[model samples]
Target: MSGQAAIVAHAQHWSGTPYHHRASLRGAGADCLGLIRGIWRAQCGAEPEPLPDYSPSWAEAGRDEALWQALMRHMTPAFVPADGQVLLFRLQSRALAKHLGIQCASGAQFIHACPRAGVVQAPLSAPWARRIVARFTFPAVFDRME
Candidate 1:
């Protein structure tokens, strides 16, 4: 019931979900947030709150720490690790962090929904590594359930 094991289970639940902007439906369409939300329900049994609709530019709005603040209120933060865990990244140094993905496989790779890849594993190379800003663990209650 470690973060890695739970994340692997969550990642499996997202397999084959097609990419779709602002969508979150398993095996049909889901963007990155959608995938995370779906898995959150699978493991936690309920979403803590509703997510407001957002435009990509929401990250650039003057006070853009909205998403990070949301995470802070809900998910438990995890130590940074190469193994599977929830990850948040700052798209720009001066901007509020807005992207998310799951660390995968010994921290060598991650699975994220991207424009080019719906959900594919990629090496945690320098560029990707540089963007990472925070790590979070799923609720400990979920770990106990596992």
Candidate 2:
């Protein structure tokens, strides 16, 4: 299968993974970023950079756009969201963007590792949609439809 197909398949395979901060083992535990990292490893091999340990509230305590900057270095910004796009969310007003989810093929739904729900597909409801701060596509093969 193609890389984008592999990514989508692998992401779907991670459904029901218990949410664990900083963890990425599929079917065991994964946080929001961990879910993305797992997808990257499945389709793109090793990550470009190692992620440092971070707290759940890291973005709120800092002024730097750490998550945004890191994603910018590896993914391409997309003017519009589509299936397989990385969705960045600013969960609070005046706060740094942090939460992330992969857009599902349907577009109307997204898969994410939620603290309360584990890894699950959820509707792109208005409240969630409004919180999105950026959309990005993974590099090279992941951008294609196959």
Candidate 3:
């Protein structure tokens, strides 16, 4: 499968999952990280690495980009806009960028797990697009039809 196909599939699966911290099951509950985990599971079988238990502040105790580091360590990076890419964003320019989502529908929109709306497809509005910090994609080998 192509990146777009896998991304579309995972994004759809995340729909209706209630937002729950560190949870990662379709239509059950999950946080941004958990949503990513669920997507990875559906696309690639199992998570490539173990997840760290994190406080709401996460690395605020140490000033490390733990989530960023983890993504780089275990996933493929995408610096440009691409369909099916995973995106990480900081709600504010001065805050820890802890949100995650996946690109969908021609890169004009994305599906993400959120505290307010659980998992849903939302437009990539200018404000939201500007908040994007990093993007990643599933590895080519992970897709059976690739």
Candidate 4:
């Protein structure tokens, strides 16, 4: 399957998983980053690197775009939103970009792991769109995956 197809499929497979901070087991629990990590593993074979432990307030306390930096190291920057693209979100006007999701339906909607709802595909509404800090696509190798 193509990367876009593979990502969407993998996300669907993880739907309804319960939210658990720092967890990534499908059908059991997963956080926002866990959801992305799971998709990467499913679509790209293995993770490029191990992740460090982080707290819920890590982003605010660090005062750095750590999550954005990590994504840049593995994925290519995307100028236009598209299917399967990864989205980084900043919950507040001055907050660091931390939340993550996978664009779906040609960017009309996205699939993300909510704290209470777990993984769900929701419309990319105006509120969500305004929070987008950056967009990225997985490396070409991901697109070439079988």
Clashing residue pairs found in predicted model 2: none
Task: Assess candidate 3 and give its TM-score to the true structure.
Answer: 0.87
Question: Tens digits of per-residue lDDT for model 3 on 1-146?
Answer: 66668667767877888888889878789887887787777667768887778754422434567788888887888877888888988775566778888888888998887778888899999998998999987765365321
lDDT of 2 by residue, 1-146 (tens): 75555666777888999999999999899999999998887666678898976678624856888899999999999887678888999988877888999887667888898888999989989999999999987887543221
* Pairs of residues at least 3 apart in sequence or in different chains that clash in candidate 4: none
Candidate numbers, best lDDT first, in rank order: 4, 2, 3, 1
Off by over 4 Å in 1: 1-3, 57-61, 141-146
Better of 2 and 3 by lDDT: 2
lDDT of 1: 0.73
The ten-residue window of minimal lDDT in model 4 covers 55-64
Estimated TM-score for each candidate: 0.85, 0.89, 0.87, 0.90
The CA lDDT at 141 in model 2 is: 57
Provide the lDDT at 85 for model 3. Answer: 86
Q: Tens-digit lDDT track for model 1 on 30-146?
A: 777777777777777778988886765424645757778888888878775846577888777677677788888778888777655676667888888899888887775365222
How many residue pairs clash in all the candidates, one count each?
A: 1, 0, 2, 0
Clashing pairs in 3: 1-145, 1-146
